[model samples]
Target: MAQNGSAPVWWKDAVIYQIYPRSFADSNGDGIGDLPGIISHMPYLERLGVDALWISPCFQSPQGDAGYDISDYRKIDPLFGTVADYEALIKEAHDHGLRIIADMVPNHTSDQHVWFKEALASEPGSAARERYLFRDGKGKDGCEPPNNWQSVFGGIAWTQEPERKDGKPRQWYLHLFDSCQPDLNWDNPEVRTEFESVLRFWLDRGVDGFRIDVAHGLIKEKGLPPYTERATMVGEDDDKTPSNAPMWDRDGVHEIYRAWHKLLASYPGDRMLVAEAWVKPLSRLARYVRPDEMQQTFNFDYLLCRWNAAKYREIITDSLEAMHEVGAITAWVMSNHDTVRHASRLGLKDAGARPQGIDAAHEQPDEALGLRRARAVIFMTLGLPGSATLYQGEELGLPDHTKLDRKYRQDPAFFRTDGKEIGRDGCRIPLPWKADGPSLGFNETGELWLPQPEQYKNYAVAVEEKDPDSPLALYRSLLAHRKAFSLGLGALEWAPERKDVVEFCNGPVRVILNCGDKEVTLPEGEILVASHAIEKPGFLPANAAVWMTEKAE
Candidate 1:
């Protein structure tokens, strides 16, 4: 077992890696990544130099939303592993000095959950139904949905239950996401008490902490008013906006987190929570990380910024300022299970456009350009003064499986919109471990839930690990230098920025990124690491970045 004397603020300066378990590795040759598979890869993570691992939801689920629609909070999904396997994984990870942050989905539950099942079977006014957002329909025959709100996936947000055999009109349930995922009513005291116990269940199991899913969507306004605008995955409303949307970033959500913060603080091992709230305006987003609330929240504004130097600088400044006000460190992320991988995203003609998914029919990305920019941005992101999140396979410079066939697509968004939206499956394909294998070494069997592209062979860990110039090598070197300099703990000091370039100093380390088309002369310093090789002395290549320390005397 690992020591529990870790600093309570360790996460502030830690580099936490997000692992999509199903796509990481497969131990049972079941064609799915599981806890055992993750256990086997513990050494690989240690080598990657991340302080913690934020494993996406592995709780018992019906796979309705790739595990987001959880059925049982206390049980591990059979597809992933048994509870014993999870315990083994936690032990193995701790032995490797890596903290485990489990994903906690609080916004909704799978319709198949025991609570939801009981809600469906019981009368409308019963305690069971009150646990979720069940309400009377609006028409004479009770055929209309409770509200005009649309689902994030598509169509109506409300799903009507089957007609009662007793001839009483059935009540409709609220599901902000897919119909299979019914949103729980946070206003219900029973629901709040149930989730608090769930948190304690995992905390007692020796896990480090949790990554809250949809952290902002737990509370809804009174009356469940109709939303006139189109429903989005992340709402635009902020604290300053008048008549804020009823579903997202409501003031009441903070109260829930305050109670959660108190619970986590009581546990040993410095257990913490990272919110996945996509609230607009850096100020509103900062509210989640207030002293008494969540310790950190994902900086979506920084992630969604255009790949321009000015835009990057602006977002970085705004983010740092906002987070500083709350006395909390910002959590920066470029890509994840939901968004397009930065390697491919930055290569698109319009890098600012956030397409749901890419296919052969869509505008193709400039592979080389994208990889170059991705590398540069990562260097700059790491140079910033806060924790960073590296998505799985990002160290290998993995690009989105843009050409994945629609037939193999599994994201609910695709089917919900009748293929109009390409869905997030392209970015969630199983990772390539070997350069050449039937399933690219993702599994012993040649089976894969979502197929890997042939080009992924070039980005395989086996291939990259052998090449010193590969992204994997760069990442390892960067992480080492980052730790050596204590960059994460250092404060940022911005230098007078040049056109198309971002320059800043973190203590003794001076970081320069050339975002322009032409190479820029490097400042006088001892070179520590560069994203791209410096062909000429004192010259930083375009779309490249380098870290340097002050020359001795």
Candidate 2:
């Protein structure tokens, strides 16, 4: 029970902060963040007022696709730390009143995983091969891929194996993502049984929940079929139609979740699971949280919405309505490890335009405007009646490091696209902890896996901590007020007085966010806080958000 049993669910109003372990902090000066580094920063997180921390994968991996290509789901990677270190981090996080949610990537496993290696060594049709989606080639001499499906990173989704020991024809395996990461056959009982055990392993270590990676993609249709509609790796086309591909948001996925729900229910501490589902139609997304499945799913629609008041209101309404219909709380997210930083994305001329590759580095963006909108969008997102996620550095208003040198880029998307797509590395740069330290206090080595921009000095935590009006301060203040007002558990009512403004009431608090090009008048009340300075009384500047006490009718 939480919030005196009124909010009952722990995740309903929790502000969960996502930590990309490789970038958050580095202990032992390894030039990469580790669990000890996370442990050391517990105080900082506690002060930030987040209720939980969703750390990205740190499982034993081959450094392929970052840590998502998990080789051993049961063990922590030496790059991060050992299992004992993870347990320590979990205990410390709990001590600080922060719930720890491990990332469970069940959709696929690293090519180097024992299961995958066994599948490759074993002949086709063997039990070892049955654990994954292994198929035979289809064309003359069986050279072509089983189907026309494409990998999310680029190229064919199916990879042909070397000649088998039995001297049989070449076999192909499905890898919806990178070829180094092979998709598992969720239809197999062995696969299901193993993951259920993996869940218990982490749960036994006292994890509060799991953020299931690629949750909608675990189960594919019985017979793999190519997506008739155009498909993108990021699933941008998923909204065009319901269930477009054999591999995405299939009906069978729910059965797996229902089983997962049962396991989580058996555990103590109200353990939960959230889906990183990119499905379309809030209704379809709602199915993942049908009282007996996932507790929440990322609202990608809100993250992709352009800078428009009407668009924001519509998506928020749809998200809230759909979640309410299913008796689940909505989860709002703006920036994450995969997407461009919202601050930088908002500065671009087109908020929804995704620029990629080295050429995109030269694109001129209005950084000031972007930071303003980034600050304002928090009010809109955090003001909504549900849980919200904050990426590591957004509280400091860090923009995407769009100008990273191409040689330093390591995202599979970049290599797969032959450097044509710079990928998500720009947003994954290590966080700046102190303004004056070598490597900006990320590590004493003055080196990082990915180089940090010299400009990061201004956005460093040390710099922002000293400024009362900094984005960090605003975040801390807003979060404190959010708790004080119970904004997360409050009821939402739209108050549309102007087309350029999105206004809503969460309980007794009124939030007004203006996204238009021109400033607009706002209703008078006890002004709580504004994203940008109020240039004139009774008015809100363009791309600004203000929260105030709701006036009596």
Quantify all predictions' global Cα lDDT against the true fold: 0.88, 0.88
Error of 2 at 199 (Å): 0.1
TM-score of each: 0.97, 0.96
What C-alpha lDDT does candidate 1 achieve relative to the native structure? 0.88
Candidate 1 colliding pairs = none
Off by over 4 Å in 1: 1-8, 235-243
lDDT tens digits, residue span 1-553, model 1: 1245644378878899999999999988878888888898899999988899999999999999999999999999999998899888888989999998999999999999999989888987999998899999988978999899888887789999987878999899999899999999999999999999999998888888899998988998899988875467642212222236788889999999999989998886668889998787778989999988988898877777767889888888989999999898989998899888989988987774578788889998998999998888888888888899999999988999999988898999899889888889988989999988798889889789899999999999899989998999999989988988888988998899889888999999998988888999888889988888899998999989988988889
TM-score result, candidate 1: 0.97
Cα lDDT of model 2 by residue, 1-553, tens digit = 1335453677888999999999999998878899999999999999999999999999999989989999999999999999999999999999999999999999999999999989888877999999999998998878999988877787788899977778778989999889999999998999999999999999999999999999889888888876654335353322443457778888999999999999988877778899998887789989999988989899888887888878888888888899999999999999899888889888988864455532344675688988989999899888888899999999999988878888888999888878766788989999999988779999888879998888899999999999999999999999999999988888999885588799999987899998888889888687888898997988889889999995557
